[model samples]
Target chain A: DAGITQSPRHKVTETGTPVTLRCHQTENHRYMYWYRQDPGHGLRLIHYSYGVKDTDKGEVSDGYSVSRSKTEDFLLTLESATSSQTSVYFCAIRPQRPSRGTGELFFGEGSRLTVL
Target chain B: AQTVTQSQPEMSVQEAETVTLSCTYDTSESDYYLFWYKQPPSRQMILVIRQEAYKQQNATENRFSVNFQKAAKSFSLKISDSQLGDAAMYFCAYWSQGGSEKLVFGKGTKLTVNP
Candidate 1:
């Protein structure tokens, strides 16, 4: 329990629709990541933010975008949802302090999305 | 780039028995970290154990222990006295030392603890 929360624990949207999932953290960690879990692919990174307004694409960033306006919130938006985008999305945070070089990630419960 | 592999897709162990999950990773970096995570039906990703590649000594946490062979590039997790609560999907992950905060994870191994 790293004080991380994700909104819309479960969602179902039609294809070509817009969907956004929110992740909020109270720990004030400097690094946040968005990952999607599929059956065979495991968990693939979608996007991550190292600091406020500083975000980068991940392995599976197509059709997905992310924003980190402040230290506590990171939002993942699907420009136009597709059936292939249906999966469980997880939000993770890590302490960016140089002292913590281990790079351990504390993850939120998860948000399950269904694009039909 | 780093890649982790978990050969076993699923495994089972009788209650109180021991079970081991295998993991192998590919990385050119000499220094890095390895981890094991558990995701139950609840879908919460929980850290089960971790090992630093530089540490010769294996890492252990209560009933969970990791056999980390830096030379073999293998990190395996052994669970003792497996409990029903341990039934879940287990993942092997890797993170480079002193690099980006990104973590690469394996496909995962689903473990079942039978009563």
Candidate 2:
């Protein structure tokens, strides 16, 4: 238990609507990541934040946007939700600082979303 | 670019037996870290084991151990005396120390422990 949690453990929405998933952490970790898991794709990174306001894109970042205005919160927004975006989203965190931590990432329970 | 490949999409083992999940990666960088994560039906991803590229000896944790072959670019996970609780989707991930803190994961291997 790394004090990581994702809101709305499950959600269902119609296509073309907007959706946002929230990731909250209590560890005050420096790095927070958003990933999506599918049948063939295990866990593909969507976006990640390094600090309070610094974020970067990952391999499968399209159709997704992230913001980290605070260290404890990382948000992933689907501007316009689509059928393809219906998948389980996971939030993960790790201390990127060398002396402060190892390379291991603690993950949240994951949020399952369905779009019709 | 870095990529991880798990050749076996599915595997099964009898309870109290041993099982090995294969993982191979492609990376030009020398310094990196590899990890295995287990996700059961609960959908929670838990870290199973980790192996650093610079470590010569294999890494092990209780029943979970890894065979690291740096030159061959292979990292495999071995579970000894598997239990029914070990049934889950096992994922192998790669992360370069010098690169972004992001992890590249393979498709994963679904493990079934039969009684």
lDDT of 1 by residue, A1-116 (tens): 78999999999999999999999999899889999999988999999999999999999999999999999999999989999999999999997666654778999989999999
Tens digit of lDDT per residue, candidate 1, span B1-115? 7889999999999999999999999999998989999999988899898788889999999999999888799999999999999999999999997576689999999999999
lDDT of each: 0.93, 0.93
Q: List TM-score (chain A only) for every prediction.
A: 0.95, 0.94
Global local distance difference test of model 2: 0.93
Once fitted onto the true fold, the runs of candidate 2 whose alpha carbons sit more than 4 angstroms away are A97-101
TM-score list, all predictions:
0.97, 0.97
Task: Give the number of the best model, judged by DockQ.
Answer: 1
Tens-digit per-residue lDDT, A1-116, candidate 2? 88998998999999999999999999898889999999988999999998988999998899999999988999999999999999999999986566533677889999999999
* DockQ of each candidate, alpha-carbon based: 0.83, 0.83
Candidate 1 yields a Cα-based lDDT of 0.93
Q: Could you give the C-alpha RMSD of every candidate to the true structure, in order shown?
A: 1.3, 1.2
